[model samples]
Target: MRTPPQRGRRQGRTTSRELILGSARKLFAEHGYAATSLREIARDAGVDPAMVHHWFGGKEELFNACVELPADPAQVLGHVGELPAELRGEALLRALLTLWDSPAQPALLALLRNVTGSKAQAALIRQVLFKRMLALAMAGLPGSAAELERRGVLVASQMIGLMVARYLLRAEPLASAGHDELAALIAPVLQHYLTGPLPGTGSAVPGTGHG
Candidate 1:
């Protein structure tokens, strides 16, 4: 009669990775992306900091794994690339549409739907927008960090609305709009939010006679 294998001793890397992931998820929900640290997650998991880095490279990668995000936010948004200021909005919009249409979209939509029912999940989504997506989109543009963040918030509102209306609610015409048509129609507005003048920035409104 052979003794049963010891499960704890046998499961080394797999168990440790799961522990890191579980710890990351709970800490991220409580403290958000910026506040959560890889070291803290590792400590919570009873793993060495080196183990967390070995498995997930960094905090961003760890967060991605916890959420089961199918694509890296950096890669998806980095599609904006380097382009003339005027051309970036359409490029960014196209990238977003492409992501939405990809096979990974189901995973993303699952996350989105979760936001409606869970405050923790909603905070997760918000943290991603502010810390990852918006920061990537707004980087290198002119303004103080606060102003840029404000612009990013406005951009987020429009993009979020488009995502919800077109994908979640299946609202008629928008849901049915061809990708190119939607991009062409909405890109300018996003562009304006991103790089154009805003009320508080001291740029005169085109028709309002106020700065």
Candidate 2:
């Protein structure tokens, strides 16, 4: 049989692990992926530095547990290029919209809502959504790799803007719009960001739409 001190130590270890997980979720929801650190999480959990490393491998693994990405955007998006050219925009938009509209949305929205209030949270959101999600979506386009990356970034910029308007700020029209309506209005713009010619390509353009 274990000694009394050993039983007490086991109970203490379980409690500490719970505390660490709780703190991690709150900090990740509040700050973001890139900004939160194991040390900071440890401090918040009121545990020793080594405890965090003992319980969770590192920040990345901790994030995977806390945020729980439902689908791997990198893996999901890799096949975007395989769709018929005309259908690509709709397909991509549908994928994103479906993911966001599902039950997973609450956690994602909570994270986004907290980002403006916490630097770490914003960093985390950016890395997950832009760096990982968009990077995977834009891979292997017919261009230089840098160009493809830039296109991915640009696409992210547009999507972020749309999300802010629709979900964050709750602007009129966009706020009231249903997912299908929003998708119709936004998918072509995303298409341009993904596969359209570069901005300086030989074309004269006139603009007439606002918002």
Candidate 3:
């Protein structure tokens, strides 16, 4: 068997596990997820390929780590399950913004930025955010599947736009806004999406109804 090449002195201080993760993150970001390989990651990390398997069970597990998802969204959302319907939107967004503003957000930003770099990343985001997280949230709600799906899409759209404006484009006002203020500004729109009537329903969305 061929011995793995040793890293130069500057790279020597880096541990094999850290090296693998860093290399994987970069490769996954630069190349699409599907194109990146454990062998390549091991080579970049200056470790034997076996080390990658020893640390991470497989490529998919490594990908999950790279993406930096916190708890599963369903699990995260479930904690607020007891919140009243009228307050759920604000409450949900408040919790989200709080999480996004925490230390975890930087990792999330890196994960998202990497994902945005390629088609494979986009597909992966769709699966994680839309299909897994949001879909589960919708299923837990008492509503038609169409309604749940539509509302989930709208919430995602708003959140994506906010992320783009706040982080990527760095729109001045929003970028500078406090998280609480931002949540206040965004929660109503989110509320509308979550409980609002379907466009063809001939009525204001549920939460918006004058009653």
Best by TM-score: 1
| Candidate 3, number of clashes | 1
* Residue 111 accuracy (lDDT) in model 2: 64
- Over the stretch 1-211, how does candidate 1's per-residue lDDT look in tens digits? 2232233764875788888988887889889888899999999999889888888888878898877778887788875745666676787788888999899888879978877867777777778777788777666778898888988888788888998999989898999999889988899888888888888887854673465
lDDT of 2 by residue, 1-211 (tens): 3232222587886787778887887787666656678899999989887777777778766776665565566556767756665556666777776776777777667766766756655655666776667655654557777776787787878777877777678898987887789878988888877777666643533464697
Models ranked on TM-score: 1, 2, 3
Candidate ordering by lDDT (highest first):
1, 3, 2
Poorest lDDT segment (10 consecutive residues) of candidate 3: 1-10
lDDT scores of the candidates, listed in order: 0.81, 0.71, 0.72
Kindly report which residue stretches of model 1 are placed more than 4 angstroms away from their true locations once superposed: 1-15, 207-211
The better candidate by lDDT, 1 or 2, is 1
Evaluate model 1: give its TM-score.
0.84
Clashing pairs in 3: 197-205
Candidate 3 structure, TM-score to reference: 0.63
Root-mean-square deviation of each candidate, in angstroms? 4.7, 6.0, 6.8
lDDT of 3 at 59: 86
